[model samples]
Each structure stands twice: as C-alpha cells, then as structure tokens.
Target: MMDTWLTNGKDEGADGGSPTVFIVDDDCSVRTALDCLLRSVGVRVRSFGSPDEFLKSKIPDEVPGCIVLDVRFPGQSGFHLQNEINRMEFPIPIVFLTGYADTRMTVKAMKAGAIDFLNKPFREEDMLDAIAQAINCHRARLSTAKNVKRVRARYDLLTPREREVFAYVATGMLNKQIAEELDISEYTVKIHRKNAMEKMEAANIVDLIRQATTLGLAVHAAQPEGMANGTANGASNRDKPSSAVSNGTEYDCTFE
Candidate 1:
C-alpha cells in the first residue's frame, strides 16, 4: 500500500479572501504536515480526510483558487474527485500528489487538465512550484471572467447607432467631422456623442480614447491628413490635450 501525503493549511479558506488549496488525504499526520508546510508560504488551505468531505465545502462564487489533491484516498479515490470536479465544472486548478508510480494515472490526470502530478516523497521545492503555478492560473482565469462580464454589460447598454458613433468617436473624430462623414447634422452628431459618452461613463474624449483602446478599438485622426485643419505653420492639434474637452470621468470599460 502506498502512503499518500496530503496537507491543508491554517490559512483561512476563500472566505478570508485568500486563494484556497484543498488537500484531501486519509492520513491525519500527512494532512497536518502539509497544512503546516503550505501555511508557511502564506497560502490558504483546507484539508479533508476524504474526497466526500471536500465535496461538501462551500467555496465562494467569486473566489479563485486551486486544489492540492491526492491520487488515492480511503473512500472515493482522487480520480473520482477529479470526475466530480469535472461534473460540477469547478474552476479551481488541481495538482495531484501520489506515492503510486503509475504512468497511466499520470496521463489520465494530465488529460483531465490537472496542473501537475507529483510523486510522493517529492521535494519541498516541487510542491511549492506546483501550488504557485495553480494560483497564477486561477488569477488569470478570474481576470478573464471579470472582463467578459464587464464587456457583456457594456454591450447590452449600447444602442446600435450609439455603437457606431462610439467607434467613430474612439477614432478621434470630432462631432462636426463625424456629422459630415455620417451625412447628419452637427446637432444630431452631438446628441449621439453625448448619449454614447454618458452610457460609457466617459466624461471627455481622453477617457473615451483610453477605454476604447483598452477594448482593442482603433483610434484614428478625425482629419484624413495630419494636424488640425486651421493650425498655424507646423503645429498639430495632437501635440496637446484639448482645452475644449475635460479629461474627467471613469470609464465602465469591458472587452467586447
């Protein structure tokens, strides 16, 4: 029989706002040891003697984290836990630690998207590296999710015409130039621009430019040729921030 080393930490779980690493193993000594080792590095950990116990945990909806799982347990095995993770679509990345030197098991875990599989009697450095990788992956996943939500919110708020105006405005088009290009009156252009700006929570053109740029929208000069239309000699309007527009207001930006 292979001895599985599983560990959990004293650091608070996701509720404490730190990233969580759930450890599942049958040995109490192993659990305590892992918990100590993990906590030493500032990672939050939750330990369970069996996979069943971990399943009952109330992980937060917004929390991002990983699981330090064992390959075998007394009750439902580590592979079963992996399957449950799949079925529930748990977002936490998993790293498996096992004493059993089974290539088949390693392949299966990797194919199932496990971040790592460390053989038992592993070096402290190896364990630390695996946990670090899992946490980084979790952070990125959360960021992407947040961006997606923000983008969806922005998209839902915009009207079709407003979106078109937003694109043109982002390209550094002035209201008058946009009006001429769209074959609409300057007054109509102003109305659309104001609505778009308000909806985007952009106080001025600079805020709009930054937000649009973040979303990968292009910023073009309003005039086809370089420089302001009525500028003297060689001076360009782009050289300075315009006094006409105030660069205030926070953008409710999101990826589209």
Candidate 2:
C-alpha cells in the first residue's frame, strides 16, 4: 500500500516572489515527472541527473527555493551532499526521496534538517506538499538573513563610544550606571545612548536588546571587568565633541 498525504497550497506568488524547486535525481523519468508536476502548479523547476551537475549550476542567493534530492547517488550519496551543502552554508531546504526506505537513513536525514523524506512511488500530493513546505522554509530563512544584514549595517554606522553605550544599554544598564562604568558624565552617556538607539532604530531598550540578541551582539553586552575599566579610562581622555547623527527618526524593523 502507498502512503498518502495532503496539504493545502499556499497563495501562489503571495509576496510577489517566484520560488524554484530543484530536483536532483539519478532517474531521468523521476526528474521529468517532478518537473512536470511542479511546473503545472506554477513552480519553477530545475532538474539534474546527478549531484555533480546540480553542484555546478549557479543558484542565486536571492532566489527563494528548496531542493528535492534522491537519497542514493552514484558518486556521492545525498546525505554526504547535504552535509557538504550545510557546511558551505547554502541555506537551501532539502526534501529527500529514496527507493530503499531504511529507518536509519530516514532518521539521519531528518536529524540533519531535511524538510521531508519519502519512499519511492510516493503520492503526488505528498511530494507537492513537501515541496511547498520546503519553499516556505527557504523563504523565511532568506528573509531573516536579509534582516540581519540590515541590522548589521546600521550597527556599523555607530561611533566607537556610541557602540559601547549601546552594549551597556542592551544589558539593562541605566544612564547613571553606564556613566559610572564608562567614567563619563551622565549627560554624555545619555547623548551617546540616545544616538545609538536612533541609529539602531530601536523603539525602546527592550526592542534594542531583542535586535542585539538576534544579531549575536549580546555577547558584547557583558563587558569584562578589565575591558570595562580600560574603556572608561580611554573614554575620559577623548574629546567632548558629539558624533554626527543621521536625521532619520523612524526605522521599519520586523520581528517574529
């Protein structure tokens, strides 16, 4: 008996984005069938007969997509290829198709982050559902990555003193505490903190902390005793001139 599965289709082109489905199968018939099936439902399809050919193809980072990979291949197994792709940080979600339904292989693939696994002669609807899930997952990941890049860019605009202030603020430090730690005037600390918040487009200290954590900048929040003291001395000797501030008053930051 064939295992059957079904899932609702998402709104086609909902975000004005075209997502591709990549099929890497050794069997020509399987490739053709998958290509036809995906294309019929408005998905862009790319098929390759071997893992080598798929690796050679240039897939753009901006394209929201997923991979439909066969488990067993001639040169390199799908599992090995998946590991290599993950090591390279390609960010494409994978759906595995295999003729031999080995329990151990399925567990490994799923543990390694495969979006879905199916045996040979799987239901067409089930494959479509897996493809849809994979594409959505890929799109969500790309969105997060883009957001991180934007946040990082804003972070880069901060002056050295402002950056220090931001780290202190993210760690729940008050203006007075930050001033004492940095050995600066309370007024100066407030000025730097305000500037950093504006540049980061944080709504409040809580929001700022969230963004910092997302960008993996939270580690800087916990300043070492020696480093904090050193920075305090350095800050004392610095000129009092304020850094130039960007005129923007609002930033559109989305978090899920």
Judging by lDDT against the true structure, name the best candidate.
2
Candidate 1 Cα errors over 4 Å, as ranges: 1-16, 87-90, 160-194, 201-256
Indicate the residue-level lDDT of 3 in model 1. 11
TM-score of each: 0.61, 0.77
Cα lDDT computed for each candidate against the true fold:
0.68, 0.73
Clashing pairs in 1: 8-35, 171-220
Q: Candidate 2: lDDT of 93? A: 80
> What would the per-residue lDDT of candidate 1 be over residues 1-256, giving only the tens digit for each residue?
0011112432132333666678888878877888998777666778888888888878665565678888886645888888887654336778898888588988899888788998877788887778777766665655655554564466458887777677778776678877877898989888988888888878788887776654556665455454455254666443222212212212221111
- lDDT of residue 197 for candidate 1: 85
TM-score result, candidate 2: 0.77
Stretches of candidate 2 above 4 Å error? 1-17, 219-256
Among residues 3 or more apart in sequence or in different chains, the pairs in candidate 2 whose N, CA or C atoms overlap within 3 Å are: none
- Residue 17's lDDT within candidate 2 is 46
